[model samples]
Target: MQSNDGPAIDETSSSSSSSSSSSSSSFSSFSSSSVTVTITKLTTNKRKSMLTVNGYEFHFKDYNKAKTIKFLRCASRNCGILLHKSFSDEFVRFSGKMTDHSHLPNTAALGIRTLREKLRQRAEHERLPLQEIAEQEVRAGLLTGHNLLHNRRKLMPPLPQSCDFNIPDEYRKDYLNRDRLLLHDSYDPQFQLHESVYKRPEGRTLVWSSDVQLKLLFDSEKLYMDGTFCTAPPNFNQVYIIQVIHHETFKLYLFH
Candidate 1:
């Protein structure tokens, strides 16, 4: 059964050569127009699906499940440009008028959005460290200094408002599907230090160590413990580190 909502595709008789030629011509025209639109699917910083038609960007606004259609609106604040797209198992077609953007196409913004998405995906899936992922992105793409902080905030998790805030699962591990790096977490709201001014625990203690570090610590005979206040992160006062001196290798290895 043919669906009434979609455009009817004509079937040509094999015996009629003229009908086949006309159908072929119509298909060629449709294919050429589809090439002109140059639709690129991309992800926004907020991880939303977006589409770029020609040079203008549009955000997914709504979907009509009954008709298998998706509606999109211009990314601009007040732009009236709208688009409709139909999808099926075989093909995707865009309806309504395209190239009717209210403002000049921002190719720079589109490029940045693409780069950010690439970085986000690499951070999640790639075994490389975040610094390496960012360095690779900078070498591959052109980035501007003006939006550095904005992009950083998008990639990093929000700072906890208080010590009682829960940490996300991703932060507890070194990478996706990798072994946990957070070795110890001692958070006590009622725990207090001996200092007279400090009545309650303002921040908790945390220790991070990797598998290799643990192996080195286990193999070493002598261990050294040191504490530093200068390099401590915000919300924490000091960083206590443990270093091991391996007997066989005769090398110093810092674990945490």
Candidate 2:
């Protein structure tokens, strides 16, 4: 009888210990899951600039989670100025106008409506049917073709000077005599100046390349060049020439 009684007491103690351990573990899990941090606004003694525009004063407020402080403007319609609470503390004490509580149309209200309309238009445009795009594209192409033909005829009028067959001897002579120096001295001086400047800088070198070389290399790599601009010379009215050399084959390519 005494041995049986000892075993029963031991079993009861073990059950109580296990239950206490389980309850502690459950409480710890609950405590961790329920834990949350709340941020509250705190008043600071720092004074900031307050702008009073139209009849309203705006104030800057300190927020705990914000990187930069936010400004709170007066809710008055006529006065849209921002007031600093620290700076406006004295003003608020005497002026009954501090809390006028009037609803005036401010810049914020104006901008809010405009932004909403813009967003709505953007959403509507995004939802447009593909058929509308196809129709617009077709119309644009037809209009562009018509404008091009009309401009070409107007620009290229029938005149003695307009004919490409006629070449003036004076113009030809002027072209040949324009480059009497044979080589451009400006190129060497500019290159030498840049090289000298870069030599003093660590891990730097002065390099120059033309658009033609850039285009050729891009094409060889199956890439395309974009954002190209073409301008005609005053007298010649022709595109500028660009030259490129192939890296592997050493072949020259010219583009205009």
Provide the lDDT at 71 for model 2: 34
Per-residue lDDT for 108-178 in model 2, tens only?
Answer: 44333334334444445776665665455446445477888887879653334321233233322222233
Model 1 off-target regions past 4 Å? 1-35, 88-99, 142-256
> How does candidate 2 score on lDDT?
0.32
Model 2 earns a TM-score of 0.17
Badly placed stretches (over 4 Å) of model 2 are 1-128, 144-147, 155-256
Q: Compare the candidates by TM-score and give the number of the best one.
A: 1
State which candidate has the highest lDDT.
1
Please list all clashing residue pairs in model 1, or write none if there are none: none
In candidate 2, position 38 carries an lDDT of: 19
Candidate 1 structure quality by residue, lDDT tens digits, 23-126? 00001111223333556666544444556666676666666545466666666766866555655212233434443454678877766766766777777788
